[model samples]
Target: MTQRSTADRAVGGLGPWLPIVLGMLTIFGPISVDIYLPSLPALRDDLAVTPALAQLTLTACLVGLALGQLLVGPLSDRFGRRRPLLVGLGVYVVAAVLCSVSISIEMLIVARVVQGVAGATGMVIAQASGRDRLDGPRLTRYYANIAVVVGSAALVGPLLGGQLAAFMDWRGIFLVLAGIGTAIWLACLTGFSESLPHDRRRAGESSILHDMRSLARDRAFVTPVLVIGLLNGAVIGYVSGASFLLQGAYGLTPQQYSYVIAAGAVTFVLGGIVAGQVGARRSPRALLPVGIGLAIAGATATLVIGVLDVGLAALIAAILAVTSGTALTVPSATTIALARRPDIAGSAAAVVGVTRYALGAAAAPLVGLGGGLSAVPLAIVMLVCTLGALGAWLAIPRAGEGASGD
Candidate 1:
């Protein structure tokens, strides 16, 4: 008989239903964020807010996600991943319902912030759980599973939101999401098991500042973290600005925009799957350059198309290319960041999580910097971010030390 590895047992023990449970929990944040996207126009009219103001709802959600992960990342390190997940889900359910009943854009923004905060708990906890149990390619596979489901939800969410907005009301989308959150939370209660054992936890310090200092000292850890953030920042730039680009520039309807966004989003999952395969064969360092190269090429193409007025097909192609490149890099980079430092997996994950969304938040405003949709401005922003990521990866010393615990 072949000797079973810890990773093999962990993967095998996941069983049929467990992936579904894990997938649902991990996807909640994206679902909550993207679902409202189709309703942006409708919400603007209903709540009597400007398009810029309506966009703030999304900004608030992104900020909340950053803050929530910031706190939960360390908390999960202290208490195992499960309890924080449970409490976070409970908060998410409440926030979702509150969003459904929100009377104004201000109320909606506040609720979205709450939902983001709560939803973030799910993402960070799920990440911590995976790090606790697996490493290298095995961990890559676990994250790939998450990327597929959550990304699929993001792909489908806008379409669903548009249809629901057309038939029922924009508020109905949140109501449905709340119900889904409740169901997912209930399922997690029975199906999930704690991965971080008591013996594995550290005894002294364990403070947020301490974790930050430790992560800062590690060159290998920080390089990948910056890459993850920049790559995600590019994606978020597209997401926040896509509506204007598709509807205004390309003359597409909400339904059409949904399809276009979904197409790009699906490739994100495909990239994640490909990254998992590549990770199994090589170190993340070997793969990072390839992924960033794709990103630079795609962003360059998008800029040319935007500047030359190359029409919708070219625009869509550019979007898909950049998104796919981003998908490939994100998980591999994240796995690298957490691969060392298993003891502070939560802290590592938290730092990475914050960097990811904080950069995303920054990208949102930068994507809008031209004061209108134009090719050169968006392209420049993306290139700046992607190049910065590439530079950071190169700057970090690759040969230094042994891998730390995740």
Candidate 2:
């Protein structure tokens, strides 16, 4: 079979609406996590679970997300994007329904794990589909657009969930998610087309292992994947602990906390917009340092303020800074890593997704290890993660070369 450039694939009859549809599909993970955050306290009380176990529900979902991508990415490469994506969405609808009616904490956690695994299909396949059809600077722009969609969802999902929690209940959030999953499934059935041609599909199970090993051997791929994971972990650490910090420590109501979260999310959107414009002009190497520097500064400051027990305004500002940096870093890092091996885009996207969510899952429970009374542990974890990301970026051999499309 002949190889094709992303430019060639762009002209290979992909519809214009595909990006928007994929963007919608890609947010399944975020929606699953963010939409029910305001209900965490209520969930604990209603289910009679401990605080640590309450956070486990989130951790379980993250674990499922990480593992699901690890499994599905290669499957899509062997099979096709549409089939795996549809199957995942079907599972997501069922899991969401189960979550809505969960009778105990254990049941809810299990349901969330299944829900996250199913949700992973959307995140991985959306990115793989983009890779299947675009490359080079076009690929970078596509990821930037995805960042924007995710940032928007980050802003909207919590606010909507907070409102729903005030009026309805925690179960109501799951019901709404089920409805959303069903809608996405229907959309996929009608509007989506297979991006990977049959000629391009990988041959066998060994091919999956081979592709994974090849990616592991490439420094260009591994470094950016690590950086993305660390940066994502930092942000997720803040998210996992934010509810307790804002509600329990700062004494804010769910509605009020949602506004604070929304403000930080606005900065995330701004960062994505800025990264898109900068990426168009500069390479990933130039953008990565700027982002990492901002993250380190923000996380360090958060650590200091949290230790001092300063006001909520300082905390929010620091969180905003970290999130803004991530908005810039994640898209550029993902584009650079995936661009390294366009032939195995599905597998590549999967590796990146798995690393990101795995690190995030590890970070979430750490925030509550100190019992979530203060934001200090959260700040410390975020700072450590940012520093780790910085180290990974610096370790990249001739990082600028990796950023280039050649």
Candidate 3:
């Protein structure tokens, strides 16, 4: 018989295909949101809905992704990771199918919400799993690797979405999403063992309130979560405004805009890898301030360039710095927060997920204010967010710079 070695047998270390599968799960929300963006006009026309009504589909997904983490995280704590994740994947598949078959905008919108919730399940569980099994440098490294994987997903989702739209209608994209969910569900059945054993399980909803209070009281936990969330707010603002900044002002085509964003994402991926390596040698905290400094400089440049209407090259360089800097900060902050409360990893990861999405949604609209004809507003949003993140980082406890940030 073959040796039955896998993620289950590996403790305190990620096994083969572990990060890959988790990366795939982590991309669920991104794929759901980005893969169908090109088909919005077609979907709107087919469902006979106004542009604003059609846009609600996107809003529904973001809201669901944010709030659903609140539900999934605690459940995983109560019942172990395996069953909840499997159930979530099943629901996601069903929701995607429902989305694909919807005849009205309302139906599609509801289905998309369900899809987002299901996506959140995988996302939170992946982070919880990392915290459950790993610690120290390994913990931070896994998260950095996840950042790289997610960057690749973000870069590819739009390109794939644009291509899929050329060949078929919007429904086909949902089918593809369903297909992706199904494959991941199958992988889960085989690859995952209960990381949070029954003995460690807490009462799901009953104790969640207590857990939240405890997490809120800890400065080490709260500060890092703020850093992660605020940096993500800056990122979402950059993403929301980039198209307008590039396509509207510079007159770049959609394809060209994508290419420019893809370049930034490549830098993001490289930054994550470099951060992970440095974190392995030092602690995640060792490089945290460096990341913040880069982000501040980049955001400052972006704000100035937007006001001055500097050359496209300078603007792209500034944006890329922001992208790479954010990448460096995220995994470290995630590790610090998660490493603080391994016992309630699910709840902790849940809070982080919720903050990121909620703040991201709040920041997104700022990019479009005043007709969004200029990049000044988006640059301002980014600058404020990065500065906020820096302030939060400074508030973190100063005693754990050499350790796992516990």
Candidate 4:
């Protein structure tokens, strides 16, 4: 019989704490983005920039996140997860401080890009580490738990940011983020052990291009990656545009918008819990159609409501549906994609991360391009993205064929 790997041993030794720790690490992206959202209007005025330029700050971060994952994922595959993670967290702390002190919109945009690059390390490694230890049904459940943590952070980050913005200025928010990054850095230094052992590490000379080619040829992997990208695009597009829609167009305050966004986030948590329970009894593949269908329904409702000029109640219900669908879809799709090649989990996780963030970066700007005041543009873009996700899901083979089709 084969002996257990370090990751397997760590899973047994750490028990419940392992997933929690990974979840905390993975939340860096959401917290960083969401916490700054309430300040976007203030930041735009303070920096004396155009609305489009202000939106670029957010777009720049998404682009950096996508590019950073592409670099760090392959490195983690060869060098192990711990050192790169620690270094990235350190950079994140410094970049947050830079953002706090930025004197102009250009400076703030550049700082956000660097901050996102550093934060991507945590996002990529956390998922890669999960893939290191778990597989099959267990992997699906682990991802569900991670989704709950992410959802909780999404719920809290904006509310806290709005409160902070009310109490102080936007600069205080970045200072708080700096403090958070510093704490996470120390935790990683002291508490986290290297999950990928030397024996399992990819050979130094292995070609990343070859790995990309291999993954591209695998329809199972490609389909899920596309679906993940499109779903995330819809979610982030909502996030990017919601502040302007609610606060600028609908005349809601930042505090009120935060409460609305937080309420919507709760549905995401509910969906995650439901997916966790359902995934155990059914194949993860079976969950895909239901998830995509809900997303389509939600997006369609949002478009219709926006065109009709309905009030916030109708809009909130539609947004809740979309977020819940994502909660159901992302974990299941991620588990299927990452399980395809356990040895190259980091690379696989990176591909998914890059695609998701890249599309999200594209979607953020589209919401503002048609004019920042209307929710109609945001609704339309989300509808298109959800439909794209559904199309990608359909491209995969039937449920019993296996996610990887190996």
Clashes of each: 7, 0, 0, 0
Model 3 TM-score, all chains together:
0.94
Which ranges of candidate 3 are over 4 A from the true structure? Answer: 1-13, 204-206, 400-406
- lDDT tens digits, residue span 222-294, model 4: 8988888999899989988888888998899867887787876787788888888888877888788888899
> Using Cα atoms with residue i matched to residue i, what is each candidate's TM-score against the true structure?
0.89, 0.88, 0.94, 0.88
> Which predicted model would earn the best lDDT?
3
Q: What CA root-mean-square deviation does each model show from the true structure?
A: 3.4, 3.4, 3.9, 3.1
lDDT score for residue 23 of model 3: 76
RMSD of 2: 3.4
lDDT of 2 by residue, 1-406 (tens): 1355533453354576677788898788788888898899998999888989988888788788888888888898888888999999999999999988999988999999999999999998899888777766667778888888888998888778878999878888899999999999998888788888777788775567788888898888888999999999999888778888889988999778778878877877888888878877777667899899999999998988989988889988888889888888888899888877776778998999988877987898898877878878998899999999999998776835554222
Q: Encode model 3's per-residue lDDT on 55-138: one tens digit a residue.
A: 899989888898789999988989888899999999999999999999888898899899899899999999999887777788
lDDT at 347 for candidate 4?
Answer: 91
- Cα miss at 101, model 1 (Å)? 3.1
The parts of candidate 2 lying over 4 Å away from their true place are 5-14, 39-56, 101-107, 166-171, 205-207, 247-253, 307-311, 368-376, 399-406
Task: Output the lDDT of residue 128, model 3.
Answer: 97
Better of 2 and 3 by TM-score: 3
Clashing pairs in 2: none
Cα lDDT for residue 289, candidate 2: 92
lDDT for 370 in candidate 1 is 69
